[model samples]
Target chain A: MEQQIVKVKNKRGVRVIPGFGLSMGITLAMLGTLVLIPLASIFISASQLSWEAFLDVVTSRQVVSGYVVSLSCAFFAALVNAVFGLMLAWVLVRYEFPGKRLMDGIIELPFALPTAVAGISLTYLYSDRGWIGALFAQAGIQIAYTRAGITIAMVFVGIPFVVRAVQPVLEKLDRQYEEAAEMLGAGRICTFFRVILPELFPALLAGFGLAFARGIGEYGSVVFIAGNIPNKTQIAPLLIMTKLEQYKYADATAIALVLLVISFLLMLFINSVQLYMQRFGRG
Target chain B: MAQKRQRTYQQDIVGDGILAVQKVREPHTEASGKGIRCGLIGICALFLFVMLVLPLAVVVINALRDGWAAYQEAVMDEYTVRALQLTLFTAVTAVAVNTVFGVFAAFLLSKFYFRGRQILAALIDIPFSISPVIAGLVFILTFGNVGWMGDFLKAHGIRIVFAVPGVVLATVFVTFPFVFRELFPVLNAQGKDEEEAAALMGAGWFTIFRKITFPHMKWALLYGVILCAARALGEFGAVSVISGHLRGKTNTLPLHVEILYNEFNTTAAFAVSSILVILAVLILIARTIVEWKKA
Candidate 1:
């Protein structure tokens, strides 16, 4: 029926697909309405503040500590996840054992599980009376409701990013370089350091960057576990939430703008690096 | 365009590289490290258990802490049911809107050529790198009281912030990229030759899409929707920011869990969480099956 309408408008030599205009128009409209506009609103609203005010909001004592806690926790999480997630990926890609499928599936638990769920569960698990917490309690080491708890939650969610990033790279890695390294009088450890590590370096960097960005933004999981004691375990994202809760719109946006810019740069850098590696890794 | 084609060529070469590696592979001293392999595998197991399994087991355990009666009481309560309804209602809505949008966007991106295409692609990807917390903040800034639309919306007496609409919008924003990302790569891989042929034969867009494009894109679309559903159901940060913590009103399951946990209603909190945890596990199963089938 629609084709019947388009048939009359069609030229003899040219074939027009129905709905191209409608589809493209709808796509662009939604893209603009849902994505571009709201994102742009951040900068536009943020611009409402004076430059000094913007600096003050982002550099306040509380905000500074938040930045410290968030950045340090995320940095630690990403650093740990990059090493351990690579190992997990290596195990999945380069080895076979019983329950391998189960292990592989479990690696994605963080991806599928709700952060709120992760938060509460991690809290319960590490709370003094909780199972894991009880163990740590015996050692006089507190895990839950601390910075360590926050880091643990960040690590939980960030690990999958690293594993997912590195798995395919490991699977497709050409073995020739390692063989050639061995032929050149290099030991296994030496060969890995010189040859295989370089190839995997880009993946590791991309994963770490992505994980760090995620950890910095992470709130749901971190909030439940973090004591949320102001300037202690409070993270930047949580600080923004607190500011928003107080109806400090400008301050919230100022902080969010900083985070937004940082995340955007990190994401952009990772994308370009990953794209380059995909194009040239094997070469 | 040339870059995308080059990436595909590289992918093919990498596939060939894998085969080449297999052909020339031989046992070496490094390959003979059975004990080390076991040790590595053991560490992986411990990591998985300590991280993934322990938390999951804890959720189940705490949910049933008071036995089946308490679990039932927690889950079947009016507020709990209401939270579930709100979560499902908005998640389904977000998924439907984004799925339609994702299809249209991916189709436009894969078929048509125009300026600013790269920008359009990058815009679709913006949500991924964005913090969920930031995502929530942006929406509130746009639609909250004293926001750009605040006056207009207030004049209309429509409440978005601290309401269901805000919750849905935030969920939509955060989960928007999943379907698009999933479908774009698949749709791009499937160029437009068949679509062009179908158009030439005088098929309507609906007919062409249903007959030709849908078959090729169905699995990818399904994959995208599943992922979108998983994310929509699990979204917390964005929804929490706008949801206002109104029990049985604005609260989704995640928010409900937060409320209960904070209230020291551990049983109820864990029970409500188990509902989502179950849903999440189901999503994981569906994803695994989808991946297995796709592979």
Candidate 2:
């Protein structure tokens, strides 16, 4: 048994594929140049600022407001997407309706559409004189150039993430559990909440995280509608741009580093939760 | 006593008959089910129409608000044409570079086992989470006037930041993961058994790839390429940062739209946007076809 184990280990070291060296070289080289080195530049530049100065730059009144606006709007947008996207995914999977295929196809429109174009078009649609905005205007509610407009733009870009994430999992879900719940005298709503929802929680969470992350980092679409109001509608990404435009590279890098760290932490949290859920589901 | 027992037995029979009738009516509950289904579908349709369809329609309507002559002039304007050329060039170059890298990276992750393999896989996804503005900013920090390579590049008379190369680099960075993300799953699912067998039979690496693996992944590769191209074409924030808004030089189509819109040239901006709208629609149609074929 010991000899066999040793032999297997030795054999494993000699990969049968001939291009391993070539593939690894290209992967590392390109990843270094395009991703790693460039990302490291943010840190390197940011390190120039002392901790106090970094704190001062990131925590100033305007910067803090940018974070507030970005976080709150992203949170609202992600929440809205979680509910609406689930509906769309459920409808697409369960129903045989007219234009179902068309609906399914266009879910990715946000992904394909340019952010700038979406920005302009959404800005136009929600502006006071625009078709949809005109109705809201009658109620004395302004959407364009406000937080409401920013949230809507975030929703537009984030719509696809949730729907796409939940779709395949929803499709693969076994109907036996649902039927069993029904047989046990559970109502439709009860079965959905107790059985179906538990099964969908992981996908839903993943979708929510992705949408939230996208919303936080989103720029082009939100910028046009945000009206660039300094203390109010300014998003964190736009703040970074504003700093870069002013040639304040150190300040820009400091803010970007903070945003990047937040994103990384969020990703790590989501990934670990997913890993845990998979293990629990298996057990 | 016998008459009372008979009456009780008759009542039991009547109760059972009524229960049977109810059981037979169970399937008719679909009437209410149909209503709920219609309502859900309606909500979805209305949501999509208000959120997505209307915005897209507005682009076309506003673009033509100034009539065909003006629309034609905006699209055919010298600067607009120049921006279009720059957009196409950046997209093509970025897609070409990333496609090559993607093939290599996907092969490395899926085909081989190594230490830190998972880390490598996760690292490729960094771009997705990073903001586009950061993406451009990173390049500036690396190659800008005050950057690490600034002295070297300047000494060599090489310009990257605020030039065409910077635009391409930023686009490439943002789009780096798309092709790899798409291709990895397909290749990983294909497994290495066939390649292993081919190698044992002394087939060359290129031969094994061409005859065995390439056929399986061609559709996925094309799908990835289309996605990459679509993204590369429309990238704004990243390109905007590094391009320095050099009119007729570094301005891509999306930046051009911003410039036109900012200048109160609403007609021209919408007209330019209409071109991207058309491109986006074409991409959508192409994506749908690829998805159908893949499935």
Candidate 3:
């Protein structure tokens, strides 16, 4: 038994502290109860419906519009977040100024604040009679209660993901590459594009994926700002919520299964891209 | 020196064109560098102000729009107080269970190698991407009257959906990954040295953990718990589905805000929001302190 223990240790590296069984038991039990089985319930329940029923729920006009609004707004917001968040990460990592610490701390407010609070604040700020909305109204622009408003809410919540994701990568990056390129007579912009951006692209992509995924599932943050008009600004998550409220449990799960499948695929795609980029960078 | 020669060569190259006269006249590019830096910083500052600071200011401003008497009235009202209690109850329940399970999962993944570990990690992150509305549906499908286990739970006289227990379960499902994600990297980075050392000294597993790993993980555990609490407290989407919107009963703070807002009671909605805003600010302050201390 002692010899077997030693061999096991050799194979998997040393881990002398005992009770792996105990920890694993606790972990698997809780995870199965809380996450695995519950998620599996969606598939199980969804399967109870016939093919026609499933198709009917998923292909409904309202559901289709919800998918479009959610994806487009999330896509646009993530794109916006990618640009501004990259810049924000760059400034946070590369510069030192007064209140920089305060600014760094402020980026995470959206993560901590209630989505309802964020929603109301955005709506209040951009409503027709509100502060920023009044300015836009004069310029013949409508923001609140439209796709623009939904996208803005998404951008607010999504900013932290990109900023947080890219900030560490930026910090750990070696400045010598850019300096080398510069010494070879490349201008700042050229060196940035040729040397720095290639290294930052993977982190940027991962950030965009995260922001986009979160925006897809986002409800409370978008619902208030969206004006919640069906086939207009409504999102898939809100549609599910509305379905469940009306006790259309089958329809709710049907829509959920679709969203769940898409989100999983997106995550898998992002993970693969990140893995590929890591290998690409190493070479 | 090579540096001096290179500088003059650059000057010569610049002197070969219109840029040359400006470089020689300025004699130092420090001012231009400073100017560029200032411009970038200015833009970042303005962007953060417009995006983050202004929205935050709006919450507080509108929450207190009607002055102290009305603000106090809204806060002291029965529904608001009930919502606060329910929110706290659900969040505390979630944090407690998630912390224990999170630590266990973290320890298992980091301390031992096993098959399906990657699968387990990915499963934990399911919550991170799953929409909260969907999060609620899965639970309802498991526990609601028309649910798969509905007959079983009813036979056992246990109510989950549309009750406080349902709210707790949904919160747990949504915030499940927060503590685990926070602790997993920290524990992995810590390695198993201290635990192994204690084991060699004839210490038991629990003793080794209590003496060594817990001390090392204390701050991270606290940070995780804080984040979990903030998320649970602020959760609107998941809680709304299971809450059933019973006034002074199932409604949490966020749901209460929605109820009031839908009723067109903007003043009360904003009033209740200020309290949640304070909670958010407190969480942010705690988070900042932790990060600052880490530095």
The model with the greater lDDT, 1 or 2, is: 2
How well is each residue in A106-161 modelled by candidate 3, as lDDT tens digits?
89889888999888889988999888999999999989999999999999989999
Categorize the docking of model 1. Answer: acceptable
In the range B1-295, model 1's lDDT, one tens digit per residue, is 8788566656645554554454345435444467778888898889889988999999999899899999999999999999999999988999999999999988888776667889888888788788898888887888887679889999999999899999999999998888888888887888876787778778889898899777878888888998899889989999998888898899999988999999999989999999998998898888888888887
Q: After superposition, how far is residue A14 of candidate 2 from its true place, in Å?
A: 5.6
- Per-candidate TM vs. native? 0.89, 0.93, 0.93
The models' CA-based lDDT, in order, is 0.86, 0.89, 0.88
Report how far off residue A265 is in candidate 2 (Å): 1.1
lDDT of 1 at B21: 50
Please write out the lDDT profile of model 3 over residues B130-181, one tens digit for every residue. 8989888888999988888999999999988989899999999999999999
Candidate 2 residue spans exceeding 4 A from truth:
A1-14, A281-283, B1-29
Interface DockQ per candidate: 0.44, 0.47, 0.55
DockQ of candidate 1 compared with the true complex:
0.44
Q: Give the better candidate number (1 or 3) by DockQ.
A: 3
- For residue B248, give model 1's deviation from the true position in Å: 1.5
Mind sharing the TM-score for model 2? 0.93
lDDT by residue (A1-283, candidate 1, tens digit) is: 5445545776332335567798889888887888788888888898889999999888899998988898899999999899899889989998877898888888878988889999999998999999999999999999998889989999999998899889989999998777776554454455566688888988888889989998999999999899899879899999999988898989999988888887887777877887887788768
Candidate 2 lDDT, tens digit per residue, A79-144?
Answer: 999999999999999998789989997888888889999999999999999998999999999999
